[model samples]
Target: MINDQLMLLERAFLNSRAFPEKRYYSHVLWAPRTGSVATFPGLSNACSSATNTASGSAAWAEVQRQLSILVAALEGAAATLRPVAEL
Candidate 1:
């Protein structure tokens, strides 16, 4: 359920004109290195390598914590707005 909400939020962000000039599709494969596979380099290189680093879990945990807070805030806002929406 949380994953679904996250995906929906992601789609909303992607569909918005927040970064009107930026190409989100191409950005996924964009990297500084040459002759390297696009997404593979990001995962195998920085992603996997970070797991062994000292702050990897801490950083990820922090992000999860922040996301939960955001989700809760959104839920609260929706609840508050529901009464007004009914009119």
Candidate 2:
């Protein structure tokens, strides 16, 4: 199940890259060669450090890793909850 979710996330990322102009999120934008930067309007100081230090591909890979961890955590938490009908 985790693998499936990760695959779907990867597909979405690819689609976003293919059509960047239509992207809804501006916090992170994909750029080649130079590292991708996070353009968080009000949160720039807090978020830019990490992305600015890494190369483009490295930054992207880290994002993917973090997303995978998040998905796994959400799935695991959901699995532990009882259905409302059971109450």
Please report the TM-score between candidate 2 and the true structure.
Answer: 0.34
lDDT of each: 0.38, 0.39
Question: RMSD per prediction, one decimal?
Answer: 10.3, 11.4
TM-score top scorer: 2
**In candidate 2, what are the lDDT values of residues 1-87, reduced to their tens digit?**
555555444343332332234465322223231223342121232234345665566545555544554455445445444243432
3, model 1: CA deviation in Å?
33
Question: For candidate 1, lDDT tens digit of each residue in 7-45?
Answer: 454333222221123434312223232223353222223
For model 2, give the RMSD to the true fold: 11.4
Worst 10 residues of 2 by lDDT: 26-35
